[model samples]
Target: MNRLRANDWLFWGSVLACYLLQLMPLPQALLPLKPWWLALVLMYWILEAPDYVSLGRAFVLGLVGDVLAGELLGEQALRLCVACFILMRFRARLRFFPMWQQALAALALLANDRIVLFAIRAVSGEAAVPASYWLAPLTGMIAWPWVFLLLDDARARARVRES
Candidate 1:
């Protein structure tokens, strides 16, 4: 309802901030450590606001990510749609998983997403990927718990405000 709508806005707004963080200029040495913020944010919404983020919304957001990052066309959109689809399909079990398990699952999801990107790059005959491509997901995994806790706290506050 209205409360959920308000919360959804908060979620999307935070996701936007994450994208900005992702795009912030940084030295090459630190780039691999940049967590996949958009994926984490989207996964949270997919878990916490399933009714708010659907396949269509995921697709659109992914398209924007693709354009923003200047990646191959449709690569991110497809990966995002697939990730969101899996998250939506398994959300019931995902929601009940312990925080450690949830972080593990998020790591797997991020790794899979990266693999998909690699596959797309290979298919497109892009340059060889460095071993560093694996680093982002690890960083993302490490960041998942923190991101989840922060978002959960934000959502709780939003819920309280609504009530």
Candidate 2:
């Protein structure tokens, strides 16, 4: 029970951290390179602990992210729901893949996220995004292994402490 509680704390703490990262300011040159931190973090959770992350939760998180980033009210929510749905649908296969394979899958997911965002903006009459807008998913792909390892290590430590 204690271990479960600790895991809960860790999950929320990581979510908070991802939100902070999303809100962090960056130079104009690097802004487009910023990966979707919340999406990546939520993907990790959805893949590792499906019971704890659902489509509704993803929608809520994306709504919060939309407010934080000052995007359209439902834009992030829609994007996140789509991403979560895909992840949940393929969780079984994704969970069993090697780390490198998982990272590739992450790349595909992030790219799909970009497509969703594009559709949302298009429907909303937003101006065309620059080529750089696509770079974040590549960066996310690069970061996936590190993010997975870091979170896995943290979870392991929490379990160890409980033991």
Candidate 3:
């Protein structure tokens, strides 16, 4: 039988925390700048723990995210699934990228994410959003390095404690 690790709490905790962050209130003006916390968290796991997090797992979390955001059902699910699929296909190249380059990859992924959402909204004939809406992914990209480091450190510490 495969051994299960003892640091499960850390993984779940970080994921939950990201979801909670996604739900946090912000000023109306600041809403446009709120990064996709859940996506960033998902990207980390997709890169660092691919064995544990896969496309199906991303889709479920995306479903939860769709509900959390009160969006059209399956919007986030389809978006996240696509992102995860792309990431999984490119994992070999991305996983080895230096932190800076990884952040670039994150920026690209998030931009692609926005494009996917835009297409969906456009298809559904949703109202146009302000130009500021496009900037949120930039903030997410800028924060990627820090988020990566913090979670990676936490994972390392969690594993050490487990050992």
Candidate 4:
């Protein structure tokens, strides 16, 4: 029975910010290193506030992301659904871990996302993914700490403001 949180606006704001970040253009050489912003934000919500961000929401978000990115329909939806499924399965343990360990978990989750991306590209007969394809997860791992801290601080501030 997860009611709408008072800080729900903060959650949606951060998600919109992530989507905007994901859409930002990057230099060709730097493109492979851009962290998966949407995945990181979704993982944070899933880990910290599972009741608010459920599997169905993840699927819907993924579909919207797919359309925005001009990707094959249902591609991101399936990947995000899988990510949510795993996160939800392990939420009991992950939710309580220290931030560093949680970042490690996020790293693993982002890696899973990359694997899914690779499979999708292969199946679609796209150019072989470069070896640098693995860099995004590592970049995402590095960014997780900062993203978590900022979002957590924002959520806390929003709670205090509401109170």
- What lDDT tens digits, residue by residue, belong to model 4 across residues 1-163? 1224656776888878978998999999999899988888888888777766787888899898889999899998899889889988998999889988988998999999889888888889995777998999999989999988888888777667666
Q: Score every model by TM-score.
A: 0.93, 0.97, 0.93, 0.92
The numbered model that scores best in TM-score is 2
Model 4 local distance difference test score: 0.85
For each of the candidates, the C-alpha root-mean-square deviation to the true structure, in angstroms, is 1.4, 0.9, 1.8, 2.2
* 81 Cα displacement, candidate 4 (Å): 0.6
Model 3, 110-135: lDDT tens digits are 99999999999999999697799799
lDDT of 2 by residue, 29-77 (tens): 9999999888788878988877778889889988988898898898889
Q: Check candidate 1 and list the clashing pairs.
A: none
User: Which pairs of residues collide in model 2?
Assistant: none
Please state the error at residue 148 of candidate 3 in Å.
Answer: 0.7
How are the candidates ranked when ordered by TM-score, highest leading? 2, 1, 3, 4
Query: Where does candidate 1 stray beyond 4 Å?
Result: none
> How many pairs in model 3 have backbone atoms within 3 A of each other, for residues 3 or more apart or on separate chains, i.e. clashes?
0
TM-score of 4: 0.92
